[model samples]
Target: YILRGWIEDRSADEARGLDRAGWATALTDPAVGTALEAVHDEPGRAWTVEELGARGGLSRSAFARRFTALVGMPPLTYLTWWRMTSAGRLLLSGDAPLSAVAQQVGYVSEFAFAKAFKREYGIAPGRYRRVENARAAS
Candidate 1:
């Protein structure tokens, strides 16, 4: 309920004219925020440090340093985390097959996708979906 309320409040804030930049004001570094936006916008893309750094107009080393300092992890680590998170969201909200979801989240192989998904969520993708569906129904 608390998480739901926070999502609602953030939606309300957007409705009241807060843009993405406004929403990201809590982040200290604009460059880090830029990198975040890039990753969120294209979690399926095969992103590299050089590419993300270029998006933020910083050199690779500087971008990695600032991103780790501000975001608490390296950029690629965050990218993989986001990919898994996006895949989980797709699982809950859509009827796409596991293979399709895996591809959409940047995995070419369903086995690899399932392995990573289990690593993150502690359940296989199908089981995770079933559990979340049951919870929602209840």
Candidate 2:
């Protein structure tokens, strides 16, 4: 719904040559795109730079350099960003427990996930879920 609308809007902007940066631009490269797609499609996978580089058919150093150059961030950084983004969406859209959300985003431990989520979002995951749900209700 909202996510689809946002994607369509971004696609429309790109179609009009708005020159936006980030994943849309980074995905134009074949090698980087392959690696990025893998990360996006299976964000819960325990990924390593070596594995991602292999998916891109490049040496680890080469893939890292190209991904960083095009994406404006390191690959793992983007992975974390995507994971947190996914978790946030799940939190907003459902009544899943925090542990489930944590596992879905690749965190095996609720404590660790909460710490990472808090670091990224500046609020703990449970509180974030509650606040966002309350705001949506209002």
Candidate 3:
């Protein structure tokens, strides 16, 4: 959430200087990309939809429709993808405990994170990390 918020805040600062003419060039601008990157950092930050929509000065409904048109996936789907992606990074990074990694990525339960992680990677997180590290080391 801190990363996402930083992205949102950074975008707000950048957008403050952009004009209507600039917005006309894009239905979803660069800030949307930044927000999307933040989402990639933590897809389970359930507030991303509301947060991203608010960043664009848009209502949730409008944001949903526009986001779908531009990003080709609804905001929630993107969020899920982002969360799973981040979880993959944590699993591969091998620097954090599974429970700690889960909490950092917004999963409150180690079991819950494991379930989701397996769903995404087709293996348990610990084994997945070990395999990846061994492969890289080789």
Q: Give all candidate RMSDs, comma-separated.
A: 7.0, 4.7, 9.1
Ranking by TM-score: 2, 1, 3
After the best TM-score superposition of candidate 1, give how far the Cα of residue 75 lies from its true spot, in angstroms: 0.7
Candidate 1 C-alpha RMSD relative to the actual structure? 7.0
**For model 1, which pairs clash?**
none
Q: Which portions of model 3 miss their true places by more than 4 Å?
A: 1-31, 37-44
Q: Write the per-residue lDDT of candidate 3 for residues 33-78, one digit (tens) a residue.
A: 5456556554556565678877777778877777666655687865
All candidates' TM-scores?
0.79, 0.85, 0.67
Instruction: Give the lDDT of residue 32 in candidate 3.
Output: 56
Give the per-residue lDDT of model 1 (tens digit) for 19-131.
Answer: 44533441546787777777777788888999888877999999888787665568897678778878888899988999999999899999999999999778999999999
The predicted structure with the larger lDDT, 2 or 3, is 2
Order the numbered candidates by lDDT, best leading.
2, 1, 3
Per-residue accuracy of model 2 over 15-107 as CA lDDT, tens digit each: 544434765667778888888778777878999988999987899999999888887678898788778877888898899999999999999
Residue 109 local lDDT, model 2? 96
Off by over 4 Å in 2: 1-19
Best by TM-score: 2
